[model samples]
Target chain A: MVVDIAPMIVLGMVILTSLAFDFTNGFHDTANAMATSIATGALKPKAAVSLSAILNLVGAFLSVEVALTVTNSVIKIQDSTGAPNPALTADGGSALLLIVLSGLIGAILWNLLTWLLGLPSSSSHALFGGLIGATIAGLGFSAVKWVGTGAKLDGVVGKVILPALLSPVIASLVAMTGTWLIYRITKTVAEKFRNDGFRWGQIGSASLISLAHGMNDAQKTMGIITLALIASGQWHDLTAVPLWVKGACAMAIAMGTYIGGWRIIRTLGKGLVEIDSPQGLAADSASAATIIVSSHLGFALSTTHVATGSIIGTGLGRKGASVRWGVALRMLVAWLITLPSAALVAALTWGIGHLVGGLAGAFVVFAILLVAAGYMLWHSRKNPVGHHNVTDEWEASPEGLAPELPKEVVR
Target chain B: MSQILLALQAAGQVLLAAVILGAGLPAMFSLGMRALAYGNGGSAEVEVEAQPHVLGKVLAYICFGVVIIAVMLGISWIVGTGMGYKLSFEHFLPVFRKK
Candidate 1:
């Protein structure tokens, strides 16, 4: 029996697309860990992302619960009716590959789009929505378990939807309490001393967040890639992810984080609220707590949501601090749209893959993905936001993001 | 559904830990700064970097020591679990185990 090259080609495509999504995930969510630190001068912007990158790499080694949740939770790759006969196995495997590839494409594209818009949306949601959409397209709606029974949460509602709805609220409340307390307890402290002291505190809190982000986000890509491997019959009966997969996912995410997403960092650090050193320490500490606990429990809470909520909470908690409610509302709308928009992208991608036929179809979809990504990269050059301008004051719709420029330049 | 309640309870646990550990650390740091003020640097106005008073300095160290312990516990919980060891806070000392 000659080995089929088509499946191999499909698997290679799956790995590549998955890594691309992981890379986007790295940069897109870097702000969640490092933004406040950068904005508050806890660390320099380049230094912040670099430190976050290193911690994330270290964090990636610390947890696999989220990865397990992602891999086994979403799609049913096998024929449950009976043991896999050759034809049935082939059909199921190929269809699963198509689903994963389209899902990754949808996720990566959505990540880049949101990055371009300076929206710190959830990369995890984009990933979930894409996979669910692809599964619906390929194996019909039955492939997705909307809700799972018992304490084991392996369904969309249990693992994905509920957390999305609740995490921001919980995160905000925790941050608000923390922020309010930090100021209350230190009410008599000198302004300069408070600022200087909290800036030092931020280093510890911010490092925890980076480690937690790595602990949480890297495993998500690991889970999806491992799922693809299992569907392709490479693992046979292997339940655990291989060491190489872990290393690759860690590297992909770390490299992406090191590159950074400056626009999102700008928006998160300076856009939502005028962050000060005290608020920065409070927000980062709250985010770290929420993320670590949730990751421990295997609830894949979005670090983006938590960070954004924590920033806004600091505004609510601190006296005389102004929260940009308009920006907050805009972010809420983006959060709501994340699921449906990513689903639409995944569905369209799956449709394209279906229309093209076999390996050629996969290749065509990959080519389109590359071109779209290239366009986004080219488009971002217009008003390139990087480490230099990342801490600029927040200007809402002014010439050249004037408000977001640092006070010295804005003056 | 029960899922909502369970999720709520889980959220509550995180919130509690967040208040005690996350928010607590920064506040403790602030207290450390305040204690340093109480020491040789009596005034908050000038910004006391040296913190020369022995008692204020010692109190500041205690406050920071508590925060550092909390941080070490947090990291151990994360990194420990990765190596198949579960670290849970119990009475007095922590319980660490291989799962």
Candidate 2:
């Protein structure tokens, strides 16, 4: 049965798909901001998520430069003449929509699968990976604007990877210096006071880290939506992000943050390393610094990676702190695979769009996605993860209960 | 006039449709979850403890802020350089000078 679809209807599908991506993005990356505090008993799981949600909203207003970059720089738009312009027809619009939706599905599925297995993966990588994969599949290799790809890659390597690799080292140095200074200056101060002082410091540091995360991570979706709009020729130039776009993206991400990515939180907060108050403070401080700086400069670095590095560095900084190499290794594997995988999914979806043709094809694809997503949600209800169980303990096991810590670590 | 109106109509249709679907569904879902959580009388208290030292906490906050700003600058510099702009600390800040 063939059904005629309107341009407006197609546009609606794309927007919904984008929001779905945003929603998944929120829960997927929540652990980046709240993991350490949850692990160290600094904040209750629910309270931590609530705080992150509010800060994410506030942070979204701070910048739109990154969104502009995403729309204009990352995705190259072409005109009807097939020249490089940002005017898109109904066909191009639907293709872009399908690619984005497929990318989100791939990312959401990967996140859930990883979370179920108690692995802390990079949500930022997952989203990028999905886009890359879908774009490659739909547009083929040539459809990828090599210049934009190259520029983005350079940023990823120099700004994202280098800083991530260095953050822990830098953090350790700063932390060691800070710790040493505290000891030297306050030798006469009581041990209890020293610990108390640092704890208060951690609270402020942790809040900043959460705020920074919102500033950097949420902009990514804004960029994606803008790219879609520009590619379809809805916008003439890469100018300001519309107020509605900003509000919607911010709201979607904030809501996701409120829901929390419990699975990742479990792995990060408890599985990787035991966090004390001082270590939590140090890690959060480092993460906040890296994320905020990256956001200001408009580098779309993964907050997950920076936060993970900080936590690892903090662990190493503390004497005899056990680092779980096995889990860390697993997370690294996911990071390596995210981009290529999502790109492939997008490409395949694009091919399907070609076969179906125009509005009919778009509807067919959208219906399939809805049915599949609905089925997944139904299946997930058998073992759902919700607010009652959105904590480290609940996420530690598949059964929504905390399992016993390993024998050596329990000591 | 007809052609221009047609183009504007197309753009408006697309934009309006996306807002309803993309932003609307998630907002509704989130609101639903929040209502459920509140109905259950969930505690609003954050469980995390504050670090005790005012000075240490202040320093950490300052350091954290500096790092975020630096990273943002670094990203912009890298992207800008790739796009053929000269790399400098000034480029990292908002005060960009015309060449």
User: Among these predicted structures, which one has the highest DockQ?
Assistant: 1
- Residue-level lDDT for A160 in candidate 1: 76
True contacts kept of each: 0.55, 0.00
What are the per-residue Cα lDDT tens digits for candidate 2 across A355-390?
887777677767766776676557556655554554
Give the CA lDDT, 0 to 100, for residue A158 in model 1. 72
Lowest lDDT 10-residue stretch of candidate 2 chain B: B41-50
In candidate 2, position A341 carries an lDDT of 56
CA RMSD of each candidate after superposition: 4.5, 14.1
lDDT of each: 0.80, 0.57
How far is A156's C-alpha from truth in model 2 (Å)? Answer: 7.0
lDDT of 1 by residue, A120-164 (tens): 989988998888788788768887778767876557777777787
Return the top candidate by lDDT.
Answer: 1
Error of 2 at A391 (Å): 5.6
